[model samples]
Target: MAQDEVEVLVVGAGQAGLAMSEHLGARGVPHLVLERDRIAERWRTGRWDSLVTNGPAWHDRFPGLEFADVDPDGFASREQVADYFAAYAEKIDAPIRCGVDVQRVQKNVGRPGFRVETSDGTIDARYVVAATGPFQKPAIPPVVPGNAKVVQLHSSSYGNPEQLPEGAVLVVGAGSSGVQIADELQRSGRQVYLSVGPHDRPPRRYRGRDFCWWLGVLNKWDEAAPPRGAEHVTIAVTGARGGHTVDFRALAADGITLVGMTSWFEDGRLHFASDLPVNIANGDATYLRMLDEADDYVARNGLDLPEEPEARVFGPDPECVVDPLRELDLATAGVTSIVWATGFVSDYGWLQVDAFDADGKPRHTRGVSSEPGIYFLGLPWQSRRGSSFIWGVWHDAAYVAEHIAIQRSYLAYDRAIRSSGPHLTADTSRHNQDDEPTVTTTGGSAVQVERAAGAQLGER
Candidate 1:
């Protein structure tokens, strides 16, 4: 088959890739987006029915598109948000190849392009954008034994309480998904137990202002100016990440018993840290204090107030108690369901590229990866204030797109030099940082095979 060529190739058609494709198309850059499934397929399939965006609708939009007729304080349901993304792709007429699973992507070492092999065909492009979301993989805890009869499902697989067997349910992980799922299960009349961890629990609203409003007012979302490595940096947690703040107090008010962090699971029962509530409460206090300081800083900085700052507290019941190292035996406790709302992991094994660091994260400055003509968007904390959020990817996308354009211009200069004659030597330094062979691949055979394949393609 003849090789398909494009100026840019995007490896995912989700929010980030779609946004990049939209921007690239608007700029008249030739690009093609490849998605393994239909656009927004994860959101449509992976989320539970009760799933609603934790952040408000206004904060959930991508660039050049807005969630229409939605209340700023109201969260968009999973279906609604998915539809919005579908509409976004339609609006832009993005050149997306849906259902095309990319098997591998490797640099054309001897050439100025990349070789992308997919289920449909092979694509060679001048640039590749890894817009596959950060949460492409779910992180399942290892504490649960494989032999247990208890039904284990990640928050991504949970759709509703009805999916659980008859009996009480123990929802593990005190993050937003765990708490929210626990609340949903309890409201469905299932006796629910939440394994609380060190987490922040702010109200959905503060002083009649949306929590998001305050987040913006205090620059909590302004991750750009934050002290590097600060854990308090706000992340955009819409869609699968759920909202940053879950109504834990409200869940407790509805009679869901909060327990300590899960230590381990044996015989289908979950063990918890006896002092779980204390840890949760302490973390809650720290968050409140941070918010208070943020409020004060905003006021001191002469920032206009959205509303009068109100005294806010964290956690549901200040007096809630938890036993240290207590075991909640699911068989004895009659809890039949275990929902792991733990978190996500980024698994990029499919992108057979040598640009990642030891931690498996793509080595990049801004969105520019160590590999030339390769970029990443929608990374956690990629930019200031919710840069990984659907809305936030726009800034990174625009910046990266502009950078790509500049690199394209430089490539033109290099091409002109090459076309002029053998008198000019290639300035190898112009290649990006990945050109430096810092570390060899873990699999020498795989690297050699890739190099051999690249060599064969170059010979073509």
Candidate 2:
């Protein structure tokens, strides 16, 4: 019913969105941040109650605000993370509109702007940024059979062991979420069965320091890259022990039954692969490779580091290695619940733009979208390996803000020139090559989007 126009319209008020808002605010850019729920709603509603950050508080700092004042050494709980975001929003005075669901975002057919359809009203924006982050939908496997007698929950919906039925629980996809949930269930005195898969289980702490500390010292953040083939890795941070690693070997030692990938469930029997030991061996081998890399880095840099105890290779027990179960009778095992922790996929169906690739991932060079006036933030490997992390989004946001400012400046200059006699062209002699608005994406090329953006936006 109402038309609100802005220079920038940012969708989603999570870490990425708020970080973008902070940068925009600092540059005196007029932008509105829209959120379907409260800020950091995912942390509030999606994660389990016992969930803590894989990294410590020091890594959670935004640009201006630092978590050092709160809990620099401790991992932040979900509530703490949500509160930190809220506090950051307040401190930055971010222009965030919560409870505003954006139904669609498309090019304005009547004008040269983007028409953002929200639950509250329509917004005509010169630029639209989708900062929804990576987790839009939970990725549950279609192989999960529907059974009326059993309860099933995705990792996003799982709260705690007490919420589940009084029986064994099958945790699928042994990534960070799966391992953590399985560990919790087992420790809570419930029989837990974990489905093992190809995963990177880096130790949370090594050499008398947190693994993240080493990562930071080696500038690993700058060299960050997800291991090829895996969507994401699970760091396996232990809850009560703080920075302890939660590897499969440790879990097995704690009496948790580890199985191979679950193939199917039919007639009260759950089928699994017999390559459970192979999976365990593969994980151990990967861990060793990472450990070696860290050692190599320390040696090459000649950085004085505390000596870790002789690293011991961990593998499954002889019995497990010799004989792996291919199936589990749910009724006999008393398994009444299953939790799927298969991660999530991005969904940008509401955005009517040719900014996505065949895989449904946004096609952006850095954070700038290929589609004019559309950008993306908080995507993994968007600019750097750290692009998706809380501490990483600020750098990308800064670049995006500067690009937008340059575009706006160009627009204003163009508008002023048009207001004068049409025969005179704007002076371009004062500008230098470096002053031109350009951004470098992962593609290793510079893209300039400012030359005629002003005149183009003027028609909106």
Candidate 3:
């Protein structure tokens, strides 16, 4: 068996792993990035054909590399995002071993580091960074009967309306993906029914600025997590239609039937929760809360941002919300295909270390796992709400890289601290102070990864 050794091993070469690789490389940390398939495979192939980023190109970017020809306010198509990551990888000269599947990672019994088993070989790495990202597996519920006679697929596998059987399409889960797919199907002359569950409806643009700008100026992305009980509530926004406010009622008016959450399928019919009205009210409440917060923020800071009156006003509820569809005979409704825009669950079953909870969630604080010499990245609310995105991941990766550099410089395991000057500090906030996500080094050249980031507006 072929085997090799590196000081550090990075698993997965998605946005997270690539960001980690560049930071570690800049810090002179001997690390190898291993990818099971291809770099940014999730973005390149795991999404729908018409999918666009939920954030504007300006804010949804890595540090230092402004998109060459994209509109700053326009959202990037999935292909463009993949290309950007590819370009960034080429520019940084990331040390990635593509097609190498990491099988298991475990702590060495007699050694102080970890034993990583991969398809290529096993490696003895002093540190391991699991940057496989949060969306490891599709979280499709088993509510649909195993023997149901209909074409059904997870949103990750969905390509377009033409990919489905020629009949009414039932799109479940009214999250970002759900609503977008539902609207698209309806426009394509397909009778579409959307199963809307609890969600947070934020405007695509508010107060003469893109919501991304508002999030930055108001520090909303810096929020640690959502309010209690709404932790998993999907943020309903879209970059589809050149980026517009996500309104269920507008979709309803467009002939897409809005239904309640799918409850069960039995007794020769599909049952739905009678909570459509409640769901609508909850989403509206959140929507209003966000608008009010923005208003207060502008007034508090004396900013001259224009007011959006239409935001404060609301029209009548949709007919489905007023009188929710509680049950439906699939044949009578003419539903022939189902698109499960359900969520995802992180897969860490291969991790032999006990760095995770009983529920399989990695136990970490700001990417630093509870177990020594282990770290996890690209998790939601890892350090902040923005951690899962590129810019956020860049900062988080820097912090993790800084931690690794600090450990190497100060600990210098089995040896004395070899003449230390100014050590590296994991200052995540210091980087956030800049408009474009720029690295701010607080130590020697070991972590001097800063590049004067570009903020030039784009036009795609």
Of candidates 3 and 1, the better by TM-score: 3
lDDT of each: 0.71, 0.78, 0.84
The local lDDT score (0 to 100) that residue 330 gets in candidate 2 is: 86
Between prediction 1 and prediction 2, which has the larger lDDT?
2
Ten-residue region with minimum lDDT total, candidate 3? 451-460
Clashing residue pairs in candidate 3 are: 70-458, 70-459, 70-460, 71-458, 71-459, 71-460
- Badly placed stretches (over 4 Å) of model 3 are 417-460
| Candidate 1 lDDT tens digits, 43-159 | 899888878877788766875667885676568888888898899999999888888988888889788889988898888989999998777888888998767867788999999
Q: Give the true-structure RMSD of model 2.
A: 5.2
* CA RMSD per model (angstroms): 8.9, 5.2, 8.8
Q: Write the per-residue lDDT of candidate 3 for residues 280-326, one digit (tens) a residue.
A: 88898888887888899999989898878988777777787788888
Q: Per-residue alpha-carbon lDDT of model 2 for 58-113, expressed as tens digits?
A: 77567577763446778888888898899989998999999999999999786677
- What's model 1's lDDT at 244? 41
Candidate no. 2 TM-score: 0.88
What is the TM-score ranking, best to worst? Answer: 3, 2, 1
